[model samples]
Target: MLLTDTHTHLYYETDDVKRAELVQRCKYNNIGRLFLPNVDAASVAMVYSLESSFPDLCYPMLGLHPCSVKENWEAELAAIKQAIHQHEIFAIGEIGIDLYWDKTFLAEQLQAFKQQIAWAKSLKLPIVIHCRDAFDEVYDVLLQEKGDDLRGIFHCFSGTVEQANKITDLGFYLGIGGVVTYKNAGLDKVVAQVSLNHLVLETDSPYLAPAPYRGKPNESSYLIYIAQKVAELHQTDLETVANITTENSKRIFGV
Candidate 1:
């Protein structure tokens, strides 16, 4: 079965030993494609280098993460614009409102999110959003900027059925990750409610590892566990889950 880890931070590991092990395991599990997202200007080199090292196996997206928004957000966005022109970014992503950790930069986060959304539409590239405890705020911007050309994945979705429907209505895909495996996550019910056609699989590795490894660091190879959970939730086989989500990944990333 073919699998696509649409969101992973393979570059987060600077240790060669761990990196090599993770890469090998992903290969063994048939995770053919991995998408790396840029966090900020500081992460640009690492993300690009990872994709450069594994051009065939990995893809990269350029954007300022909501959590990374700070005082000098304009400078960061400027750097992103320059990089977008210089690099072959698969998407403009890992961008959205993240009000969970710090609310001090709420204004900056909102501005950055809207600016990045404009960039995605201007570049005609898909976006990967990172919404956390700010679905309504994110939806407000998406609504204000709504257009036929705007599209992307709602990375690490943890919303209700109504929110899921609103997302699909905007031509966005729900990025289902390890959260669905949690007994009380209720993400399984969300998954069961949404069709496979609108779902995509992700690991968000080095974080949010599925059950059996819930509290531990996540890795791309562990995507198999998330896939198995999705299969069970959909009342289907693993290969079916793999095939459908793989196609959804390809459809969005065009990779």
Candidate 2:
């Protein structure tokens, strides 16, 4: 069974020994593909370094995360854009409106999100969104920019069935992660209701670890747990979940 973590920040683990252990764990768990989305200019190098170290296992994506949209967001975006040009990226994201942490930069966040969407469109690449508490705002922008060219994954989607429909209708895949394993996250219910055709798996590592490790640091290796939960929710086998979700990742990343 080959599983794909459509979103992860495994690059954050810089210790070579520990990082190798993380990758080895992923391999042991059959998590063959890991997509890394850099949050800002500073993280671009980290993302690329991990990808280079595991050329066949890690894929890199570039974008200005909404939470990173500070006063100097323009400069950050410029740096990320320059980096995007210098290397091959599978997607332009973990970008979207995130109003959960602070509402101070809502306007800036919107601008950054839209700008990154434009970058994805221009590059003919998919986007990976990080919607927090601004799904309405993000959905509105996506509606405005709706087209054949706009397509990507809604990373770490923990929304309602209605919202899931809205995203899938836009040709975007719903990125399910460790949250689904939470006893009360209600994401399992949503996943059970939605078809696997419009769904993908992720870990969003260094955060949102699944149950049995909920309060600990998350890693791509734990993706097997998330995949197992998804398989349980869908009433299917692990191999089926792995096959379908990995194929969906390939569809989105074109890799």
Candidate 3:
């Protein structure tokens, strides 16, 4: 069964150069595609480098992460725009309101988020959201700003069923990651009720590792455990889980 990790940061500047080998491991484990997202101006080069090195296997996204929002948000946004123009990005992603970490730039984050959304809309591209602890606010933005032009995935979706319904209503898909395999993840209930059409597999690697490897750094190879857990939760077979999630991924990413 083939799986796709729709969210992952395999090209961290501080990360070791073992990422290429990690990609090999993911291929060995059937996690064939990698969707790489940029955090800010600093990450554009790295995001492109990895995508350039593995064009057929790895895809890149141009977006400013919520955590990277700050006083110089305009400059950062300009840089993100530059990346979009400089490379063929897969989507405008890892972009959304994240109030959990710091609210100092919440206002700026909101503005930047909307700007990116409009930019993506103008380009006729889908977005990949990174919503963390600001579901209501994020949902509000989608409702207010999306307006049929916006469509994408909610990365690392660990929300209530009501939230899932709302997001998909906006023509988006949920990015279920290794978090679903955790003991107290609470995603089993979510996936049990949500249809396979609304779900897509992701590892969010170098983060949110699954149950068997919960404490370890995540990688695409661990997506099989996530797919298994999802299949079991949805009362279906592994192949069905892999196939549908992959199709959902392809639909959202246009790949």
Candidate 4:
């Protein structure tokens, strides 16, 4: 069975030995494919380095993260756009509106989000969104840009079923991550109701680790736990979950 982690920042590890170990663990767990999304211009090299090291296993994406939107966002976006043209990326993301930490850059975030969406459309590539506490704001922008080319994954989705429906209806898939395995995250209930066709698996490593590894540093290898939880929620087996979600990833990344 081949499991796909549609969203992961495993490149953040930096340590060659530790990074290799993480990749080995993922392979051992049948997690064969991993898509890497760089948050900003500074992270582009890291993402490309990981993909270069494991060219067959890792796919790269470029974008400016909402959290990274600051006073110098215009320059950062220009640098990221230049990097995007230099490489063949699978998607343009881990981009969207984030209102969890601070709302000071709400206007900037909206502008950056819309600009990235246009980039994705122009390139005919899928996007991987990173929506936090700004679902309504993000969804509003998405609605404004709705089209055949406006499609991607809603990364690290921890929203309600209604939100899930809204995303799927727009031809985007819900990126199910470690939160689905949490006991009280309520994402499990939402996953149980959403069809597997509209769902994709992710770890968002170094961030939201699945249970047992929760509150600790996460890695791509832990994707198996999230997949297993999804399998249980969907009343299916691990292989089925792996097959479906991995196929869904292929559809989104086109790799």
lDDT of 3: 0.87
Candidate 3 residue spans exceeding 4 A from truth: 13-17
Tens digits of lDDT, candidate 2, 62-127:
999999999999999999999999999999998999898999999999889888989999999999
Q: Count the backbone clashes (under 3 Å) in each candidate.
A: 0, 0, 0, 0
**What would the TM-scores of all predictions be?**
0.98, 0.99, 0.96, 0.99
- Cα distance off (Å), candidate 3, residue 138: 0.5
Name the runs in model 1 displaced over 4 angstroms: none
Order of quality (lDDT): 2, 4, 1, 3
lDDT of each: 0.92, 0.94, 0.87, 0.93
For candidate 1, the per-residue lDDT at 30 reads: 86
Pairs that collide, model 4: none
After superposition on all CA atoms, what RMSD does each candidate show versus the true structure? 0.9, 0.6, 1.4, 0.7
Clashing pairs in 1: none
- Lowest lDDT 10-mer window, candidate 4? 246-255
Looking at model 2, which ten-residue stretch has the lowest summed lDDT? Answer: 109-118
Q: Per-residue lDDT of 108-212 in model 1, one digit per residue for the tens?
A: 999999889888888888999999999999999989988887999999998999999999999999999999999988999989989999999999998999989
Name the candidate that leads on lDDT. 2
Q: How far is candidate 1 from the true structure (C-alpha RMSD, Å)?
A: 0.9
